[model samples]
Target: MSEVMGQQKNNLELNDNFEDHDSVSDSQVVDYLFAHPDFFVKHAHLFEELDIPHAHKGSVSLVELQSEQLRKKVRLLNYKLNQLISIARQNEQIYRVYADLNLRLLATQSMEEMQLVLEEVMQERLQLESVVIKPFIGAYAFPEIQRRLFVEKRFRRDKFFFGRLSEHERKLLFPQQEANSVALLLLGELGELGMLAVSSKDPSHFNPDMDTLLITQLQQFLSILLPKLMKY
Candidate 1:
């Protein structure tokens, strides 16, 4: 009975915590700021602070309540608005990086040329990051050269890395990160076909939240392009 009571108490506490968070979220101060982006620059700080919990001291007089509430409203709204602005800036930068990459990828006429050009683009476009062209492993080869690369056992075997690695033979061809780094495939070809890895001293630089479509499309561009380019 005691154990059961403890579990019940724990559940109650969790439910209460959830309710408090929901109440704060429903305050909608941050939402209003986001909807009107123009107000953000002046009131961003308030929202940022309000994102976390704030307590009213018990000794505070009721007269101060109005000002206190206003401060909280502004603080939380400011933080959230700043976050949105930051996201917009980051997305703009990522788009530019891919745009620069596409320009170079389309210019290559052969697999070797593409590799050189892609790596050069990744380096210049993404702060000297290293890139690799990984063909699919453990699957049927469309043509002859890929079969040879497979037979030669030239592949990096890591499922943590993604993109086009034909459902079979996959390997790491180029790398610049440390022995232990969490990498996000920000953009690439398919079957690990065309992949990019950015390295930084900060271990969290490559955490999983990054968007990978840009790199994925790049991989797609290379998958067919590499095979056709080899002929030239």
Candidate 2:
């Protein structure tokens, strides 16, 4: 009986030791790999032997799984690269169109010719819904009260206003045309010359946060040109 009891105690202690040794956690394994980073480099054959559970396929070799993950990352990078390229090409085209319009504007002899040139480029080339130039004190001037209100409200701080306009403002600026979104440029040094309203069908097309580099150049050129044209 003593011999049997001693044997049983020895068996229990061996089992307990085995359980403790087998209790290696996933975190401990990860820490071990992180410490010995070159372990995989030394035992490269493990890449073939190790199985990584896959969502689509039942399981894949470590090398194959890593290759797939890399391919997905490359595809995502390519998609973003293509989007940037497309935007750059669009910006270049816009710059060319504005450059051509500037040249045409420089050659205009009268205000009528200037207005026609603006309408032609903005409507036809830029594909804007409408374009209207309203001089402060002239035959085709915006209503005095309306002009003052717009200057006070829209051009209170900035020389440019973008995004949606009130119904009254829309009607005054674009008479019969639909203007979901509008870009209102205050002409002259202190916005005394006129207002140049450019509209688009797309509601989100003209936002205040949009880059004004091209339109700013146009505004400066118009400010200098309008005074000379108004004299005629």
Candidate 3:
């Protein structure tokens, strides 16, 4: 009976202390925990009982929540690393293709030879559906729509355009074949000399979202090379 009375007294004292400190802030508790690192070691069972609110799921143990966050971070890092590797591989492949095309262009002695080499590279190497290199001298002879496209200088700002082409545009560039998308590169001083058009059968093959580094490099190469070819 005496022991029971003593336990009841201790409980009453603890309750009174809690009531006195009813407005204890979270920061104060955190600071106390940080100061006494062995607090959890003395009450190790708290690891099993402590519940933390999760972002996606219901309340979980603190350890489980921390582990889940680490796993998510690792997964995100792996996905970003994979994307970087894919981009590097794609860049390497594009470099090889450009190198081969440059070597072929160097071997050409005449304008016809240069055109044939370009067509071969576009068809066989790049797997394009159609390729056309047209001079600006006869731009007025094309249909009214095409003549307007050239006369209006639509590509004067960027020197290039890429995406799905209209029916008339497709017909004007790829008359012998069908194309779902196209990349039009204005050659030689903003369409002053001509234009180079490359078409693909896939609708999304040449969208605006794609990186145009390869096409831009090719345009610069052609701009320098075409004038020399025409002179010969």
TM-score for all models, in order of appearance = 0.49, 0.88, 0.71
- Each model's total of backbone clashes: 35, 0, 0
**Per-residue alpha-carbon lDDT of model 3 for 111-220, expressed as tens digits?**
67978988888888888888878766542323556655854654756888888767776777788886898888877875566788888998999988888887888888
Model 3 C-alpha RMSD to native: 5.8
C-alpha lDDT of candidate 1 relative to the true structure: 0.54
Order by TM-score, highest first:
2, 3, 1
Of the candidates numbered 2 and 3, which has the greater lDDT value?
A: 2
After best superposition, candidate 2 residue 173: deviation in angstroms? 0.9
Question: Candidate 2, residues 56-98: lDDT per residue as tens digits?
Answer: 8999999998899899999999999999999999999999999
lDDT of 2 at 30: 94
Global lDDT scores for all candidate models:
0.54, 0.92, 0.81
Error of 1 at 53 (Å): 20
For all predictions, the C-alpha RMSD in Å is 17.5, 5.2, 5.8
Model 2, runs deviating above 4 Å: 1-21
